[model samples]
Target chain A: MSDSDAQNLREVRAIIARHKLGDLIFLVTGLLVLMIAVLTFIALFSHMLIDGLPRLSWDFFTSFPSRRPGSAGILSAWVGTTLVMIVTAAAAVPLGVGAGIYLEEYAPKNILTEIIEINVTNLAGVPSIIYGLLALSLFVHQLGFGQSILSAGLALALLILPIVIVATREAIRAIPVTIREGAYALGATKWQTVSDHLLPYSAAGILTGIIIGLARAIGETAPIITIGALTFIAFLPPSPFKEEFPYISFEWLMAPFTVMPIQMFNWVSRPEEAFQVNAAAAGLVLVIMTLTMNALAIYLRYRMRKNLKW
Target chain B: MQFPVTARRSDNTPDSSTLGYNYRRHLSERFIEAMLFLTAFVSVAITLAIVVMLVTESLSFFKHVSLWEFLTDTQWTPLFDNAHYGILPLVSGTVVSSAVALLVAIPMGTITAIYLSEFAPFTVREMAKPFLELLGGVPTVVYGYFALLFVTPLLQKIFPELPGFSLLSAGLVMGIMIIPYVSSMAEDAMRAVPMHLREGSYAMGATRFQTAVRVVMPGAFSGIAAAYILGISRAVGETMVVAIAAGMQPNLTWNPMEPAATITAYIVQVSLGDLPHGSIGYQTIFAAGLTLLLITLVFNIIGHLLRKRFREVY
Candidate 1:
């Protein structure tokens, strides 16, 4: 009787084992898929480091692009990149934050606000090249800004405006509903509550969004390219100061510019293998800048989440 | 008159208005609210301006090339010595690359999502997500650089027949670029599945893997589909990687090994070239851009609708 029972259990075990095989296969496949992504990224990063390390020198950072690969530096490129970023951040942050505050607080729950919400969502996903088209027509020709840093910055601001708005909204939403109600109870105006209480409370989160959005703006190449950012720029933008009493100058904004990504694009498009090495170095710098920005944003978000109990 | 009367009537309230504080505060508040509203309206204006800009330019372009001919034309060589305005070449190229990307991204991303949502330990999931997002944060131009400088060489070793610049590399790398997008969105959806449902599945003797695939995945299908479609739209609009790795020549062929030009790539090419502002050559790009925008807008709307539908259900 005992032997028969053992045999029946063995048969049941075999049946269960067959079903378990699918689970193992599925688990392994999932791990393998994730591994593929991790490995490809590793390979890409390491390859850039290897190719670019030799080219990273003081001269490389200080000088401008040259005809020879050995002499070409990213001075103009980095400066232009920074300037464009400054412009984009300046343009996008306040407007996006204001829009976000209005959408979340002041606007009534209605169809027109709904349309604005949808438009922002839709704009966030629009092919960046389309923004370039808009800029080319509206900014470059219609307004006659031409292919300048201001135009490129304005274009990127549009491209990233949706991102900033979404991030700001998410950040402000994380603040408790009770907080807003408390402001209302205090007889504070809506704007006062937002500017004094909400903005200060969500400042870190808003900064995080602005940083991430700027990080995204810095990495973008497509829209700027469409607006005719050059590959061969060797001069700095006009100085922002003058010999006159009024030192500040706005003319630099109108000057032609080429950002790091555009510079990389320019070099990488060359037929020469040497230029590819040049591209790698520029790519490395851009990657480092972008990654640091993202890491800072992530750290800010993590800290904000962890430290806040309510 | 009403403001001063109300200010004086409320004896319990502080008489700040007598010192001009209330008046100043009221004015500033109104000004700021209006300012914020105006800022919000700017975004709406930007959208309207985009539509206006594209349509007006496209209308002028259509005067030269009929809409039917532009749509039905089989070649797209506006820069060539003999011009052709057919958009099929660029459209096919975009479709092929996007298709290849989706085919690679969907299974890979979904599996990773399932594992992260249902199987991975907390530490592993936490560490993995940021790194995956970092991949997404990497610029498309960098992806393009990788595709041109590294991936093409790697693929050439395997296929031996693959071109230096082909849709194969761009599409595959673009898939990798989109993995975080798909996995993160899908994982969010799967995680949103009520824990009770998983407990119910477990009580019925279903394994975690079985429950994930059979129970949670179906419940999250709308979000997953939305994510997949959004990824497709991204791949379609992607410019740098395709423009860098895919060739400039417009080929309508479906073969990945062969070179093709995407709509974004065509726009890049034309803009990089010198053309007069008002000429047909310049106008041609706007028309192409209009087409690209419409195509992406359709997918985006569908994805949005699906997400809204999914949100309602939850």
Candidate 2:
């Protein structure tokens, strides 16, 4: 072989060797870092779980909280979280989905529309605490909702609205324009086409989006904390309109409530080891709830994608 | 004569008649469309209203305390009788902790991204990405709890004077929490690089590592930078972790081993207790929040702009 050919071969081999070395280094380091992170995550949870699980029973789920750490259960917080999630979903879905449809199908392509799109994108990035502040000023103070679950849900609904709108728009946009054209050809009105055909087709995607949004809202603490979600509540909230309402005639709307994270925060911040265990148990419950919701959403999205004929 | 008879019959049929039925259908369609528009309008109005209200309240706050005092003052004793309005300590704490988090996150996150995109087997890459993302999905409060219970104790075992809650503990946890943010963004950028570049380097006898480090990384630098900045924004805005893990004292010191207060932590601390509205202490929370909002907003805008500016057409 020519000297040049031999030299080229040698260089190629050296390059390959160096490449292998680099890959090894990168892979080892990356895996190490990830292992560290995952281990920390497990350790953190384990510390809580190990100490708290024996204490956690059916009664813990059913019982009211107490100043005595051992007797306290997160029943009020659990109830509060459920009510907030329901109210937030109710308020967010219609408005978010409607706004999404309009943007995707009916809105004019103009600078104003562009501005609104940009604004929504930016809104998704705004800190959750800012929304809490907004809720405090507008809902709690001005609207006289005080520190009620209604105010907290409204704040959360607003926080997740941008995500819902974005996801809904994507779902709506995925429907073929040919479907709308086909409806038009059949002499069906635009509204009928959207309601009867398009909405149903996009239903699964919209549902997945709503679930994801709900998960995010449920995990959020800053906004609710900002809105003065009580850190401790011994009693479950009465129905929003019941006569035994705590404060204003809109007593349900004015009553204070604790959420899972806020409760966890309160417990974790306490100096006692026992409270730390309680925080872990609460964290475990919160994580399980969120993960289950997310898993359901993923399953629904898979089914939707699979069933989409077009 | 037959066609004329048929046309007359069609006109006589009310449902088949074009004018009245078509007009009514058009009106109803327009009404629903109008309703959809109204919903869109309301969302826009809500977002704008929030911004307007925050700014208006913050403006009232500014009137009472000069911007210089708010920005320059190092002591944050708003709740106490001796109220020092300086926001510097909180600002410095936020910056330092976020900086530390970025220090740990960027190299590791970028390398992981590189490995996933260029080096790792497809199965490995797929599994790693989602598993890393689980970190992001974990609530910040959990991270805070972990930092306090797990990380702080572990650190104390090694460094005896390490405060039970220190900035290092919080920063370390924050860094772990943001790994997914950085890795996912960086991976997207790396994936966006043209395959031809990698192939060409390989054909020229460059090894995979060389191609990735010299060609792919430089090609994806802008995107990686954007990811890093976004991670910083997330760390800065993060409240629960820092609030719970990094102690509440707004000390001006730069030591990572010491307990320090960040802006978000300060807000959390103050808001936990009942401070009536219009009090200087309560207003200070808004002031600190405003500062945090502006910092994050600027970072987000810059990151967005960079992504837009450098977006590869192909």
Candidate 3:
């Protein structure tokens, strides 16, 4: 080979090496970009834990809000959150599941079905605060639910209805067409097939969806705040038990309440450092609650995918 | 039922009673179907209720304040004695914060997507998935706290004159909070691009980076645009971060260093205070909400269309 040809070969190698360097630089940059998210997660969690760990105690769970920062606790808030969650689950599960079944199995492919599908997708994107406005007008005023636990529960029920419906539909869709055909060949009616086969098979997915929806609802502060949930409640809602012949009571649903997030918001807005500590503690609890639910959903999804054959 | 029975008898088959249809079961099935249909219709009812509520309340608001003034005025002090019902300040604040957030989220999110979709090994992808989910799962209020206590202090170290509650801190935290959302969606879009396209790029002697950026990105452009639109919607609608960290003072400015209120933060601030129903203060929130809904709806529709287009293409 000539010396000039050797020089051309060397230049070609140099150009290829330059491109490889660019690739290496981007790979590092991409990893660093992704690390921003991971690092933020660590920082936020540690920040809350450090600020809040000392505030966690048995008494902290048993007491109520107070004028004094050191004495205030989350008793009313947690109880309210629990009750609202119960109401939310009760209202959302049946409606969302039923809707999912209808859309997936019953509804004909027509204009109305298309409209409903589009509406559900768009509803998922509506801001949570707007739901608050809807509740404030419709439930608080027009329906006279006031700022009660039932109103807040119903509001969240509406907010998460789309999520549950989507999850349920996706789960139902995953079941093979052969299952439906087999059910039909067995002389089973549509409802019978759905009850025996479809609903049973999709139960895990539906539960995961419910847990996720409830988790999202639990941390939501804006809608509850917009519906006029009090920030400084010192007493819990009336319990759902009676000492009379009828042992179940419904009065608790109409009682005013404050949730965990709202309580944190109240404390965060306060002008004192002690209150900030309380807020951080409450935030830590809230984060744990949501993260645990999401983790459970992920685990359930993994197991479902692993266990199912078709 | 009659036709089937007569035909069977005419053909000299066995009595049809044994195979007769059960009308009771049929009726019950119809009832259940109707019930489920109603359940599905509830979502439509919700959409109607939202539009109606916002419209009626905003109608009352516009009754008192002209639409032109609400659109063009620079001030937005509805609670004070000298009330000016301009929405520009809130709009400007929302715009600036969302811009700041997108500036951080779009590039970071796109690069993260490229890395995850094109380059990450299996174990790396598995580990990173949960990290992203956890990041997305963290509550906005907690993010608000972080922005207020951690990020602001860190920023203040670099720029001493930065206020304790500036949009810059809140916007940055908001961007970090949004990273998981943007990256996951964009990654899904890029991964959906067929493997043959990447192979073609590789066959042409292109590097992995070149294939991902030049071939995969262009192939997935519509889907990525949809993801960016979603990130924008989330930023615009985000409340607690700006409410907690960015001061709720509605200032008409584009500078991220100065404190201002986004439409969401403004609504939260008003809700935190007591304003009687039917009062102007109350009505203002609805008007602001209507504006927010309109903005997000536009983005959502565009995103939905883009998603549909990309799904069809692939």
Candidate 4:
């Protein structure tokens, strides 16, 4: 070959090599970034496990919180979390589902509908603590619920309302338009169509949304704190059931309560080394609860997406 | 020839039973619709309630403390005997910590998104998706514990003088917590870039990396910007990690190494302390909360507008 031609060939190879090197560098960098996120997860979990595993036991689940770290357990915290979740679910589901149904099915494309849509989006972006302020003013003071389980539940219900509404709308929107038309052709009323076809079809997605919302609510501490959840509660709310004429009582709704995250926060803020261990234990439990809920929601979503042919 | 459908039905429905049944059905349907509308309106009610609550309480606060002092004062000592009401210290702490967190999250999250969307195999993507979800799913309180008890000590080893409650550790952990949010959203945006665009890039002999950085990144720029804005909102609104790991003292400083209270942590501190209702101390939290809400709202609006404006129909 001529010298000029050989030189051109060499320069072409050099350019290709340079591009290939850039690609390789980016590949390594991307892997490192991914690893950093994954490793943080592993590290956070293992750190809690190492510090907290020994603290998890039967006594730990049975006893109430105490000033002494050794005997302090999460009994009150767990019970409160459960009861608050019950109230939150009871309050949020009906309202959120109704709203979702209305927006997706009944509402026309109008200015009012647009306003409602924008409001839901903005509500979702509002900080959790602001919800606490709202609850403190509207529920605790005006509604006279005080710093009770009912108030906390109502606060969280409001906090997660947007999530449920969005999830329900997305799930409803996923159903083919033909289904709605088919129902209408059968002379089914709007409520009847929604009750029979739309809800049944979208039940799984709605449940996933509720579970995820509840999971988020359970971990929320600032709002609960702002609404004044007692940091050290030694007893559970009055029993939800009664032996009297009425087999069920709602008095527990008015009783004060504390939850898991607050319990962890309380312990973590302590200066003692022993409290830190308890905090880690509580942290482990909280993490497990949230992660399990999230995992279940994700699994349900995946299965729903896979199974639903439409 | 001009008879309407409703008039025809009315003329044909002669039986009393049919008329009664239709009337009952109409009444019930109307009732149900009203109920549904009311439920839908509850969300709007909530927004209104939040705005009213914050503004009224903050108005009460401003009555006690001038808006000028609240805006420009550097010290935030509502509970102290001297009782300065400046919000700048908290603002400074919030800005510095969020800046630190964004520094860590944006680059890492963008890189992770690009890798997952453009480079990772299907199996790797599947594994990473759940892993990232779990990472994000961990409660902020647990993150606070990790930051305080684990990360802070580890950092102290690097810088022996690093305080046990430095903003650096909390910000780092908060960034880690936010990575999932950024990466997932950005990945969705990049993946939404039409396949033909990538094909065109490859037709010109561009490598996968080049295609992602050049063609896809620009295509998804608005979406990525939205994702970053979301990360900023989350970092700014985050409470528990800073409350537990960063000191509650509202020091007006920009150094991330020094401990200071963010807006969120200050609210938590005040909430934990017992201040009677209607007290200036109590009202201070509302003012702080209003500030926090306004900051997040601005970012959220920008993000929403960006997503709306640049959403590719293709």
Candidate 5:
């Protein structure tokens, strides 16, 4: 063989060797990095649990915040969180589902519908804190709802509404057009077909989406903090029950509230060692709440994918 | 051939009764349709309301601080008596931290995506995805705590002179928080690349890694770019971690080790205090909010356009 041809063959072999080495390095590091990341996550959770368990007790979950770390509890925060979540779900769920139904089932192929679609998409990605500013201007001040659970819940509702709407629309869109056509051929009206076949089929997907949205909302601190949710809510909002006429009260709507995340934030900011432990415990609780919701969503999605024929 | 009419139902029920039932059903349908339309219009209304709220408040802010100085000034000391209205400090802080976040996130997240899509078995992919998402969904406040209490300390050990609250901690945690978003989106894009292309690469004597890196990555570049842009947008607007760990000082520095205030952090700082509505302090935060809004808006629009372009290819 000529010397140049010999050189070319050698270079090709060298290149292949280099590529094979590179491939091994790439595979090893790729798996290693993900492994480290996930292990760190587990470590972080364990750290929280270890640091927090000593501080956990019946009293820790029952009493209100106090000057002493030992006596301080998440009672007010959890109660306020539940109350706000109630209002948020009440407002957001129906509106989001209806909008999703309309966009998927009813919207015409026109610019208006496209605008609505883009609007929802943009809103879904807007910084949650900007929703806070919007809530501050529109609901709390302009509407004179004051700094109350009603305002906080309404703000969260708006924040999560886009998420819910997007999820619902995706679910509805997944149903075959032929399925709807069959319903139409059976003389079912548009609304009837939607309320019966479409809604039932998509319910698992839509519900899972809503739960995910709500989970995100539960973890939200920026918007709630922006709406000026009291960082140190001492007393719970007045009971919705009353002794007088009308029997039920809306007074709690205007009462100030704090949520689990905000309370944890406040504790984390404190310089005291005891408060940091308190923060860890509260963090653990919040993590539990969020993970449960996510697990539910994942399970629902898996079941829906498996059981559905199409 | 004409189809049999549903009007043949008049054989079972009176024609007038059938007509009445159809009319009632039509009215109900119209009512329900109108309600649904209004529901959908709520999103449109929300978009309008956000724009109006930001503009109206920002106008009041501009009245107090000239637009020229507001944009040009280097110092952002609005809370002090000698109020310098320059947004450079805040913008610089945002830039330094977000750049750090992207530097860490883009590589780790993309690598994770590649591993999951190209190498991992189905069970491994399924198991890893949920954990990644869980990591993503951990509240920012919790992350803020982790940064301030844990990450900053770890960095201080490494650097010995790192500040108690530095952009490094906040930026790193933000990177960790954003991994799921980047990886998941990019993975979906990479998976969408046609199988034939990879098979073709193999037929050409290319290694799987070579096919993935050279062919699949470039094919999915638009989606990856879009994912990265959205990830940057999120890191830019993130508030809690920066507020807690990135230091409260709005110093105009390029150093990630130094504490700085992002636009979101500044707004959070102002809001945490009881700033009265229409006051200059409140207006300033509104102005900051507007700036943050515009930045994210630019990124979102670009990402959307790129994704749209990608959709046209196949």
Candidate 6:
């Protein structure tokens, strides 16, 4: 080869090396950002856990709030959260699961069904605050629910309905078609086949979805805030229903309550140092609850996948 | 001709009792089907309700303020006396923060995805996947606090002029919050790329880096773009982080060291207090919400369409 040609080849190789260097820089920077994000989460949790442990005794779990920071336990908030979850689940499960079953099994593949599917997908991404506004308008002002747990729960239920339905549909779809065919061959009706076979087969997955959905609902603050869940309720919820009389009636549902996230928000917003500490503590509790629910979901999903037979 | 008349009639007639049973069963099935249809109808109703309500409220808002003033004005002092109704500053803040976040998130997330999918061992990839998802599962409020208390302080050490609640800190944390979203989607896209393409590049004596950069990355570009758009939507609609870390100042400055507010943050600020019905300030919140909702809706729709368009048939 000529000397001039060899020089040209060297130059070309140098340019390629520079380009490779740039790619390495991009890769390194990207990895660094991800590392920072992970570290931030770990730091926050560790800080809260460390600061919160000494104060987190049995009394913290059982007692109600007091004038002192050390004295105020999250019992009221705990019970209130449970009440909200129960109410939300009670309203959302039947409606969401029924919708899922309908869409997956019964609904015709038509324009209307298409619209419904798109709407549900869009609803999943709608800002939580919008749901809060809807709840405020329809429940608080129009229906005269007046900032009660029922309104908050109903709003949350609506917020999570799309997610639940999507998950439920996935679970239902995972069931093989032959089971339904077998039932049909046995002279069983459509409803009978779904109820006796499909539902049971998909129960574990459905439960996992419900649990995860509930975890999401529990962490949600915007909708409940919009529905005016009390920032600090001194009293525990009376019942899950709205009525006082007719013991099991719906009238007991209209009682006011405070959820854990809302409580954390309220406390965090306060300028006082005590409230900040309280907020951190409350945050810890909320995280624990969410993590527990998440763990349960993972466990159930694993179990379901293992037991699922093709 | 010799057969008895009753026996001949019975043989010729259909079984009436069996027919009655079939008719009842059909009716019951129809009823159940109708109930199932009702459930689907309810989902539609929820969407309709949100759209209708936002439109009505926004219409009321537009009646008082002209669209030009709402969109063009630089100052956004809706709560104070002599309130100017311009939404530009808020929009600028939102855009700037989201852009900064995307700048940080896209490269980071895409690289991490590449590393996990292409480079990492199976065990390392398995451990890292959940760790990345853990970032997603953390509540936004916690991120908000962390940004305000931790990240802002850290930024102050570097940029001494940075305010207590500057756009830089908020943008950084928001970027961090969005990393998992982009990474997971990009990973899925990269994983979907046909292995034959990579093998062909390898046969041509391409280095691993060269193949990833030229072949795999280009193949996954559409999915990455979709992830980027969705990440922007999340940043735009994000409330708690911007509300806490990005100071509630509607400044039209481009500098990241200064305080600024976003549309979602502005809504949160307004919604905290009691605003009487029919007031311009209350109406403005709805107007702002309308803008936010529309912008995000557009992004989401575009992202969905792009994903559909570029989806690999295989």
Lowest lDDT block of 10, candidate 2 chain A: A242-251
Q: Give Cα-based local distance difference scores for all models.
A: 0.88, 0.82, 0.91, 0.91, 0.89, 0.79
Off by over 4 Å in 4: B1-8
Q: Give the TM-score of candidate 4.
A: 0.97
Write the number of the candidate with greater TM-score, choosing between 1 and 3.
Answer: 3
| Number of the top-ranking candidate, with DockQ as the measure | 4
Off by over 4 Å in 6: A1-34, A62-70, A240-252, B1-15, B277-279
Ranking by DockQ: 4, 1, 5, 3, 2, 6
lDDT tens digits by residue: candidate 5, B180-252? 8999999988998999889999999898799999989988988888789879888998988898888778999
- Model 3 docking grade: medium
Tell me the deviation in Å of residue A58 in model 6: 3.6
Candidate 4 local lDDT, residue A242 = 87
**lDDT per residue (tens digit) for residues B289-310 in model 6:** 7788898899988888887787
Q: Which residue runs of candidate 1 sit more than 4 Å off their true CA positions? A: A1-12, A242-244, B1-24, B308-312
lDDT agreement of model 3 with the native = 0.91
What's the ranking of the predictions by lDDT, best on top?
A: 4, 3, 5, 1, 2, 6
Clashing pairs in 4: none
Per-residue alpha-carbon lDDT of candidate 5 for residues A24-125, written as tens digits (9 for 90 to 100):
888898899798788768766887888888888898899899899889999999999898998999999999999999998888889999999989988877
True-structure Cα RMSD, model 6:
5.5
**In candidate 1, which residue pairs get closer than 3 Å at backbone N, Cα or C atoms, i.e. clash?**
none
Lowest summed lDDT across 10 adjacent residues in model 6 chain A is found at A238-247
TM-score of 3: 0.96
For model 4, how does the per-residue alpha-carbon lDDT over B204-296 read when each residue is reduced to its tens digit?
Answer: 999888999999998998889888988999999999999999989999999999999999999999889888989999999999999999999
Residue range B1-314, candidate 2, lDDT tens digits: 00111112344566645656666766787788889888777667877877787687778888888988888877878888787888988988898888878887887787778878887887887677656655667788888988898888899999999988789999998988888889999999999999999999999877777898898988887888788887888888888988999898998978899888998888888778897877777777777778888998899888888877766655
Winner by TM-score between candidate 6 and candidate 1: 1
lDDT at B251, model 6: 83
Return whichever of 2 and 5 wins on DockQ.
Answer: 5
Q: Is candidate 3 or 5 superior in TM-score?
A: 3
